[model samples]
Target: MRKPQVHWDDVEIGGELAGFDIEIKPRRVFLQISGSQDWYPVHHDPAFARKGGHEDIFMNTGFTQAALVRMITDWMGDGGFLRKLYFEMRRQQRPGDTMACRGKVTDRYRKDGEGWVEVDVWAENEREGVTSPGRAWVILPMRESS
Candidate 1:
């Protein structure tokens, strides 16, 4: 589905992007593991996770990265193209935890005639202050050029 377009001229540096909250469930964790072909038992088996010293089954880094990317693109809409995404996994996200994904536009500029915005993004849980911290570069289409 095409999302509402966010024009380059309308963006603001230091502006907060739309954020989302999600409750991580065991089913969702399993789905992510199956979809991503991540067959590691730590992602889907709580017993295995406990053996590894974690409280329970936790999300994989690859899945977490994909979710962060979704958070950015979903807010930027269809007109925004993700140029780069980098993140560090600070903490493990477990089932029954609510994760808040948020972002802020840090910088905006024109590069090679294309408008770009650099965003600082993160996912925080009630227990873990920050689970994943990352940055992304997105290209937003200009209204005049579109």
Candidate 2:
């Protein structure tokens, strides 16, 4: 059976969007950057990253941000538009580290005839180290409307 879609009015303050847990790997990072045509050597070259003061190549921050959007949009389904996104990089994610993305709705309201939900988002590594924290605003459909 198909699951129900989330309606704008149905998302409450403090509602949580359970996110996917991911492990960072060199190959995956390489593929992501390559596929996106973001060919910064620091994202794919360990030696270069070491010269850059990192133990190894780091995951692209853009990919991480995209993942954050995917997390909330996946829950909101197809009827939502990402309105605003802002983030701060707190720590580096090295290869082999597991990270979890989490989001919590902070407010839900209508503005300019659009249903909007503001959320606080966070990403943490397996050691409970916060890598990036951010805020997102999404526009969702009202109940009984697409």
Candidate 3:
């Protein structure tokens, strides 16, 4: 199916949007797990992760959440700006797994003569289920008349 190209006027109170899939690799995981210099074995050591009850080293929650935002921005395009974004982690995302990021428009309105859209968003991992789910608000440029 063709992807959605949502104009400011095309958004509604309950419009839904499909998410795209992304695969998590070790290198990506390294980029995501950034906080401290602590060499926590679980984060980078597969052996330690296994001992900690995880199958292997996993990506950081913050990184996965950020991916959700990137997904939304890519979907909305450069003409859209993110106003608000929030998410909660539901599961762990191990390497080699693919996950989907999705969103649905729950509200839309005009403020200060600009168009805004609110969306319910989520990220689902094949190995760990819905890794994150949350809401976002974006302001898109007004569409021009044909």
TM-scores of the models, in the given order? 0.90, 0.89, 0.74
The residue ranges of model 1 lying beyond 4 angstroms of the native Cα positions read none
Query: Mind giving the per-residue lDDT tens digits that candidate 3 earns over 1-146?
Result: 55456678877777677578878787766666564344566767899899988878866665666677777887687678998888887677778988688888888888988888889998887666777879998998787761
Q: By the lDDT metric, which is better: model 2 or model 3?
A: 2
How well is each residue in 6-98 modelled by candidate 1, as lDDT tens digits?
888889989998888878986788778776889889889889989999888888887888789878888788878999999998897888888
Give the Å shift of residue 113 in candidate 2: 2.0
**Model 1 lDDT at residue 99:** 83
Candidate 2: regions farther than 4 A off: 1-3, 144-146
- Which lDDT values do the candidates have, in the order given? 0.87, 0.83, 0.76
Best by lDDT: 1
Candidate rank order under lDDT: 1, 2, 3
Off by over 4 Å in 3: 1-6, 30-41, 50-55, 144-146
As a whole number from 0 to 100, the lDDT of residue 78 in candidate 3 is 69
| Candidate 2: pairs in clash | none
Q: Is candidate 1 or candidate 2 better by lDDT?
A: 1
RMSD to the true structure for each prediction, in A, is 1.9, 2.2, 4.3
